[model samples]
Target: MRLAPVSLSLVESVLAKPVLDEKGMILVGAGVKLSERMITRLKQLGVSSLYIEDKRTDDIVIVDAVSDETRRSAVNTVYNSMLSMIETERGARRASRPQIGREISRVFQDILADLKANNSGLINLASIFTVDGYLYHHSVNVAILSTALGLAKGYGQKEITEIGVGALLHDIGCTKVPQEILNKPGRYSDLEYELMKKHAEWGYEMLREQDGVSLLSAHIAYQHHERNDGSGYPRGLKGDEIHEYSKIVGMCDVYEALTSKRFHREAFLPHEALEFILGGGTALFDLSLVRLFAKNVAVYPIGMTVKLNTDETAVVVSLNPEYPQRPVVRLLTDEYGRRLDSPYDIDLTKELTMMIVSYNE
Candidate 1:
């Protein structure tokens, strides 16, 4: 059935197996019928065609991109499972459920496959938005990023899965805190901040009790915020004192948090967030891990329109992995921002006079 605003809930309920075709159209689910009103709405919205599950609507479905159901499943599985695990641990009994860990790992693997497939494109940064729901979305993004970094660093699949599981449940301790504290819109009082810091302790206690969970998993919850300079909370371990896995997760967590929007503060753009992290030197995170992340992640991904140093306008077409700060762009318009029938890609770092002035939504 056609959807007006493309509600994810409705999509999951109605479409069992939607697919995207090569042409970028959505395929409808099998054995489902669309109402005429829904069809009208889709047309009004300029969704030219969609691919359906069966051969009947094959022409409509185009690109086999990620489906809303897949996205929702990923979000819910991560969120609800973590909540249950944390709650179980808080009671002082074992909370480690091998099933939960496996589930989280499975979802993470799926997300990583998708991201890697579309690596250089406009990253589906939507996963980082907490606009409506929280916890699950953020966890999924962290898992994907951490896994990506691990993959780029040549870690084996087994180690990546362990790290991915750890990243997903790192914030499970937040479940023990009151909603008022977790969702506080402004700075917390000292008392509240103190309580907040206790999450790490709470998380560690809970994970320690669970069966089949690794030491690294619990350690991540306890150490994600610790800094290399010994300024981090819970423990003041300095320099090489912090575990290597903890250090990697620490950098990933902060990067994800800075890039994510919250009720408290606006999310920084990727470039701005990375700059802040880099500027911190080795004070806030592992310098080597931070540098690796900066190299791999696309700061200004494709499909994002941007302004150039020469006051001209362009759209990113690909990345210069060696120098993430300098990406190749397609000159789509002039300084006046007029459209061009054809665009040419330019390497901004090689072009001495050109820099990215700003990014466009």
Candidate 2:
């Protein structure tokens, strides 16, 4: 399967993967042939890309670090918990429900178990969701990415849970913001930006008051925005003053947000987003954690078509666990832009001189 941008040209293509809703339910099942109407509807839903069945790359598989069941359960849990908070703030409910912290903690335990079962240890967050579900999906993606980073950093189960739970509810304070500001399609005004920055403090206060939520976890919400150079918001604590867990969650938050398509701008490819993160190392984030993230996350996901420095075109077939940035790819076209009759594979780790220059060409 190959990942292609959603357009009218894809009307006849079959879906390689299921399109999921915010609740994790399948809106369109895999192997279904797309029609003009379906494609138009998908575009309306803000689906920028789709995995299309390609005979040449049929063998290439995009594996999620966590299982479908685990991911769905996590998304549903986040959606309900956050929605409940939003309702409470609006006075639609008497008060925010109790046990939110405990509920999220339990869901995260399942996520951890799934991650441990996967031997790859590399993360590929390839799930497709609509723009409206961005908050829930973003929260879940952050938790998954944060959990993977925690494991890579040699954290124990207890420490991993703390970071994972914190990552899950990091943006819970957005529930307190007005819907108009939160859902605005364009950049915020000066005053609106100030209100937006208040989410961190609001989230920290909300989480701290919840049962089963630790003070440390609540602090993750508070300090996730704080930069290592004291350039971030809320408190702007510098260097070691920010908690280690907050730093991890904050880095993951930025990465997830960048890679996700937003109302204001197109999503950055994995490699592009990683480059931005690496460029901000030490100044905006902890250098050590940034390096760890670069090592563990897949910069080029499976099935993505990329142009090589050698002027050839190839599709990433698998990841190099130890060197995720250098994936094994299958050559699809020659340097002269002619399609190969029989494509061959190349392990980028073995061919260190060759590199991917761009993707989705």
Best by lDDT: 2
- Give the Cα-based TM-score of candidate 2 against the true structure: 0.94
* Cα-based TM-score, every candidate: 0.74, 0.94
Q: How many pairs in model 2 have backbone atoms within 3 A of each other, for residues 3 or more apart or on separate chains, i.e. clashes?
A: 0
Error of 1 at 250 (Å): 0.6
Candidate 1 lDDT (Cα, whole model)? 0.64
Q: Give the Cα error of residue 188 in candidate 1, in Å.
A: 1.9
Q: What RMSD does each model have against the real structure?
A: 8.3, 1.9
Report every candidate's CA lDDT: 0.64, 0.88
Candidate 2 lDDT by residue in tens digits, 278-312: 99979999999999899888898888888999899
Model 2 — which ten-residue stretch has the worst lDDT? 89-98
